[model samples]
Target: MKLLLVEDDSDYAATLSRALEAMGHDVVVARDGVAAIEFNDRDQFDAIILDRMLPQMDGTTLVERLRERGQTLPVLMLSALGQSIDKVDGLKAGADDYVVKPTSVGEIDARLHALVRARGWKGEGATTLRAGAILVNPGKHRAWYGDDALDLSNLEFKLLAELTRHAGSFVTRTMLLERVWGYDFEPATNIIEVQIRALRRKLTASGSPDPIVTKRGVGYMLEA
Candidate 1:
């Protein structure tokens, strides 16, 4: 899952981001509501873990704004313990679920899964995504190009899934590093180049034209 984690506490955010990434979820941290909005606008995410009390703009207000913008993605609000709770406000404002701070990552993961299932991802988070002849089913951990089954390693499968998710759009190296590799820092190795080449090779081995496009220094785009 690609996740947007909104929190102001650096230590808590870092700790939670590590835990979530260890669970195979790609997490992007946003320190405040303003930054959260920017991240939300620039990238796609399966869900958002938001802090209720945020600087610049509060979580509830942010939820309202997001809804007003026609964004229906699941938002799980994090409320600090001992604070006055407002279940009505959050629900009315369009937050899907609420979790108290200091909750287990397992619980958060479960809630996120449940939310996705309940909403059926509003089609955007469908179980399978397709890019022209390419088909990727993350839930089943399988992919295919045309009629040929793709026997992909875990990394290749993830890379393909990311490209399929944003079909026709350039998925930058930085985005792939964060989403597909789950790395906050860029490594010295040419992991992206290697994996992309492997994917391209497999994709075209069956006599199909290469659908993945290299935009020079920009990034890669999978033809739609």
Candidate 2:
């Protein structure tokens, strides 16, 4: 995986960069929070490793700013401060995973995998979600459209949840495979198209116009 490692400590950054490289990850080292933010804008990375404390902008503030700008890449916050409250604060600021400093490479790698895997699984903690005329209760796996309850199966619910999460943006078939089906490898079947058709049928059963848009040769998008 390609990663952005942000740290003010040059020696530590070098050491960590080497270790990460040895582990087969491409690492870009950024010296401080300002550099980290700039690097993020200039490139795309699978994940970001941000130091909790940095010169100029702190880690938490940087992540919050990134989120405000609609940067959705997974972030793994690294900090020497290991308090529960500190971890909570980092997560609330949009860091996907928070780990105390002095962690093993194995742990960091594992957490990175977990963060990416959990990206579109909103059913974990989200109670309710709204996208245009659609309302979803993820906990109960129930949905509604303008007073009409939607009847959805397990895969259908997951698909709808992912589309609604990125309501105004295009959700590619590759994205659906990974996020909804949790498949790392693309399958040789048309399962996504099949399921999408099934979902559209149920969603429009009440005479509601189809909310999903298919961009040919591209992907799908949900209109809000």
Candidate 3:
């Protein structure tokens, strides 16, 4: 994921950037709220880690401005002010999530991921999807492989629905993480592979040919 880190403290920004980069995200630093808004205008990013207080525009004001301009990107506001009123102000101004200062970096990462997940399928407008032998009805929370009804867990259903949308195109691990789990980067676990194996088993349980194709060093594609 590409992230915008808005922090006036150069040292804190550097450390946070390094940590997020190590998590497989691309980080762009904006030292002030005005600069952050400028960066937003120039390019798209997955999310923003914004500081509550800054030189020019404060984080809450920045969030309000962004919302006024119809920007729906997720934002995580960090503040030394841990008062309930401070957090309420951030959310009312349209920050997706707020964290008090000195919070664990892992907690911050988790909150960012949660925010993205909450908005995951908003832009896609996905409905029932089909690819060759597979059919997935997201609204119905159901799927079928050529008349063989599939009983899938929530995760499996989401994974299959994503693959069915692409049909013949390769869906990379990173893409699956973002779309299915709202994760911006590949996790340390073999979650994608594990889900793929489960989905394959169900798709082939009725003696149909395996429709999922795996490419070495690439990704997975569902045959059409």
| Candidate 3 Cα lDDT to native | 0.84
Instruction: Tell me how far the alpha carbon of residue 66 in candidate 1 is from the true structure, in angstroms, after superposition.
Output: 0.4
Clashes of each: 0, 0, 0
Report residue 30 deviation for candidate 1 (angstroms). 0.4
TM-scores of the candidates are 0.55, 0.54, 0.54
Candidate 3: residue pairs that collide: none
lDDT of 1 at 83: 40
Q: State, as a TM-score between 0 and 1, how close model 3 is to the true structure.
A: 0.54
Ranking by TM-score: 1, 3, 2
Q: What are the lDDT scores of the predictions, listed in order?
A: 0.85, 0.84, 0.84
Q: Which residue segments of model 1 deviate by more than 4 Å?
A: 81-85, 122-224
User: How well does candidate 2 score on lDDT at residue 171?
Assistant: 93
When 1 and 2 are scored with TM-score, the better candidate is: 1
Pick the winner on TM-score between candidates 2 and 3.
Answer: 3
Number of clashes found in candidate 1: 0
Better of 1 and 3 by lDDT: 1
By descending lDDT, how would the candidates be arranged? 1, 3, 2
The window of 10 residues in a row where model 3 has the poorest summed lDDT is 121-130
